[model samples]
Target: MSIRKNVLFACLTIIGLLPLSFANAAPDDVFIFSGTRLPTALSEVGSSVSTITAEQIKQKGYRTALDVVEEFAGVTVNQNGGFGGVGSVRIRGALSEQTLVLIDGVPVNDPSSPGGGFDFARIDTSNIAKIEVLKGNQSTLWGSDAIGGVVSITTKIATSPKAIKAYVEAGSFSTYKGGSEISLSNDLGSFRGAFSGMTTNGISKAESGDGNAERDGFDSKTFSGNGLIYLPASAKITAAILYNDSMLEYDGWGAQTGVSDADVTSETEELSGHITLSLPLFKGRLENTFLTGYSETERNYFTSGSKTYDYFGDRLLFRYQGTLNANETNRIAFGAEHEKTTSGRDENSIDSLFILYEIKPMKNATISAAVRVDDHSVFGSETTSRFSAVYRPHNDWKIHGSWAEGFKAPTIFQLSYYFPYSSKVSGNQDLNPETSKSFDVGVERAFLKSRGIIGVTYFRQNTKNQIDYIDGWYENVNKVKSKGIEVAGEYRLSDALGFEVDYSYIDAKKGDGNRQLSVPKNSGSARLIFAPSKVLSAAITMRHNGLEKNTYGNVKSWNRLDINGSYKLSSKLELYGTIENIFDEEYQQVYGYGTPGTSANVGLRLSM
Candidate 1:
């Protein structure tokens, strides 16, 4: 039998056997705010979504957002080197740029970036409360650049009267990490802030197979702050900011035209902030929110300490939203948003209006419809819509389905390329915004008595006007198709012991029937956890990264195992440890970039 067919059969047989091997009840206490822009039960959302809570982050030793989302289905992460290296994420076969990333619901994608995508490498998790991931097209509610869905991060804002938390860690390659968080809450308002930094004498990015000796290193610092002032009549004012500065040394292509140097360096700074006012009126039936924010990103690349190139991107956002709780079962929401992207090249602005209605026809069913129209200064107009429904036959089984449209505007470089060299690529001024239509259906079963839960989802997305190089210039000539299946389950044998597994299979291709680059066809991840007592908790996680075609060659599948644990020694002190790549899996997520081997770290946290 062929390898692809064999792999498919093995995956099905394994997932098909999970329910019989273990038992558990609904693990749906997770509250999601991104799916509907309001706090809603996990089981009620019609999309395939995942959440990583603060507790889970600690238990799994998740140091970055990338670590937290690796286990999610239909997600693939690629790194250029070791810790703090450039990272890219592809969701459900969509292009990396298609995924919309938000910090506190504020878009952070760099407009100057090659394709205007968020760089996962720059994210820091100093005071994150949760990471919410939504799959499939979400352009209807979120507007453009959300075709692949959204990854929204919420930082910790709630505080005690007085609290301070600190942590430190040290390990291989002269690596060091530390962070501190402080919070104050009073009758009038609340304030919280966090600071973190990390530095490492890292590994070689370009491996010669004989063990390259050139070492690449990185240093970074991050800060987060949130403040709120409670006003009279159930109103509040809030301010928030996030910042990061980092420097990294990496290898550039060797002698090849597209390759970089061996000792290339990069320095970057990014800042995003927001101020908001919220009010509740009409006897708590009507609510309103107003927000404005700005984001700036700048990067400089150099060789031999001499700056070779630089780029800067900035964005501004203003939004107003209102919600009406019409009755016990009917809810309505509407919003208007304006966003502008500015690079040195051009300033483009877009105005968007959106509305969503949710209906609970009965106790066991919820139906929602959303529509959005975006008017761009350059591209004229585009409209998108979504319809979703969820039905619960009983407390244990939920069936859900959704149909949605997607849209993405052409990038600045793609539309304004004007290099003088004959060899330089040119752009098209008349390129249309890319668009897509997608649908998904899924079934989930939850058991009672805290036994366990299982879910399977099937999805398909067809995209048109996918920008590609045709006849030596960028054009919308590709029609791409992507389909996938996701199977996830969590089982608990006892109150203190449990296991989880998530699997994804994707068949993605471009118009000419070529496999998508950097997209894995089959991948799976599993985790086992034990919490024998209130003071002790640990988990072992295993992940499989499937095959893909890359510049380095047809990369093979690889697996890794990581173990993390925590022990509470006292009310004010705790110890934690993590061992990564336990079996020394020497594989690469991005070809040519060296992957880390087995490494261990120890840390301590003091909290009050």
Candidate 2:
């Protein structure tokens, strides 16, 4: 047998010999972080939220953060090639630039990108504690680029006095990966460190036909550090840093299509860091945090080992967040923020102020209202607002609804890139900010002794002054109307079996009479998991992406299946394997791209 096949066989053999357990249990309550800048209870959120816990990532053997987000409702992923390629995500039929991504309360969007979107393909899942996806128009808390929603990623921090963990894995296509983490905590302070890297000889960027045989490969490395110092009073100092460097190969850019055999490469690096002082006053009834952060992104394009293009973007942010618990049933949060952005010779900045108030009118009902006003260097001033409510008629049901206003400002690329590189399609400095108003309603219930949950949601939004390419010029000429429905269910059938399913339908259109590009109208996903033994568990996943139109033409719908398994050898060691594209599906999310075929990988984890 081949070396790869042998590794898979060995992992299965070890799991087959382990003893079985029949007892299973579920928690009475699952809480997500809450507060103004933090997380809150799931029951209190009025928007559509899809969360993937750390335990779920490990149990499913997911290697990348994008893998976990793709299974959620109202989400679709588009990739140019295999792993490490340019990957973009669309939420609720919203534009890629409308989605905001955050890491530990810091913005990671790149103004240097074509549309100011974060490429999900570069996010590693090694040390992530949880990923929270809040869907719908959410511009109340976060300012711009939240016309779609927010993706909040929180990394693990040092909680134990001292601990260390490491992992290594290898698989097909000459791929290898490794990572290590260390943590230390005490009454005085806490510290954490982590490092991870992955490389692979990936598949080609073009399709299989036309003698396209050359491969496009990728390499990525990341490092993070976190520290907290205890203070004399009821307060502490927190600081963190995240850095990444990635190099990948693709076919072409600008106007031409990708070539099969080429050395065109792009190297990207990102750095983000923040420091904050949190304090408590009035015996903990009032809380305050002062924070400042800096984020920068850079990219270099090369052809035949010679540099061709260089780009850099930087952002500086400052904020003071305060929250007051006026009483047991009322809460108030307010914050002030200032931000500055720089790209090339173009510089722009903004100042903002916002306030939020929450009240519990009834024992099982909560209502909130917030308003924000932003003063931009270019667009003057704009005001946005939000109102939401959540009600629990009984212990078995929760209902939520919200009406929100959102906005997306013009990025450097869209406003001024035309000045330096003037082509037929030049930038327009007279562009205005895009605006949106949306409404959503949903209900959820738990049954069968709280072992299962089912929910359905309906949402709609209307956006005005949207910037687009009209008649070969940048203009705010499109008014977009989008709406969707999401239905989901999760049931633990018994002690040894469990299953879940999610489906979404979207009908999006522009006032100018055209369907949104690449926006799929129907999609769904399902998963089945089995744990026949205490030491072993396995899961199978299936996804269906419906038909959509692309620049090349109309594309057909496609389905994919994947299988993953894990085995615990001891308290400190575990083995895992994955089979992606189990059915050998051949399809493309974008035109003229090569999709990943069936592949396998095996890995081990050790902790102490």
Tens-place lDDT per residue, model 2, 18-67, is 22321222211435442234335777766678888788888777888778
What overall lDDT goes with each candidate model?
0.83, 0.81
lDDT at residue 294 of model 1 (Cα atoms): 73
Clashes of each: 10, 4
lDDT string, candidate 1, 1-608, tens digits: 13223433432332232222222222225464888876578878887788888878888788888887888988988888767788878889988899998888789898887578888886766678889888889998788899888888888774566679999999888889999987766666666778999999888876535346777899999988777666899797777778899999988875422233376899999877777888999987888999887777889999889999888888888999898899989998899999988876687999999999999999999999999999989988899999989999988899999999999999886777664553645668878888999999999998865499999999999999988655456778568899999999999989899999999999989998988888999998999999999999999999998998875476679999999999999999999999999998888787767777889889999999
Candidate 2 residue pairs in backbone clash: 33-39, 33-40, 34-39, 34-40
Off-target runs (Cα >4 Å) in candidate 2 are 1-39, 253-261, 419-425, 470-472
Candidate whose lDDT is highest = 1
lDDT score, candidate 2, position 276: 78
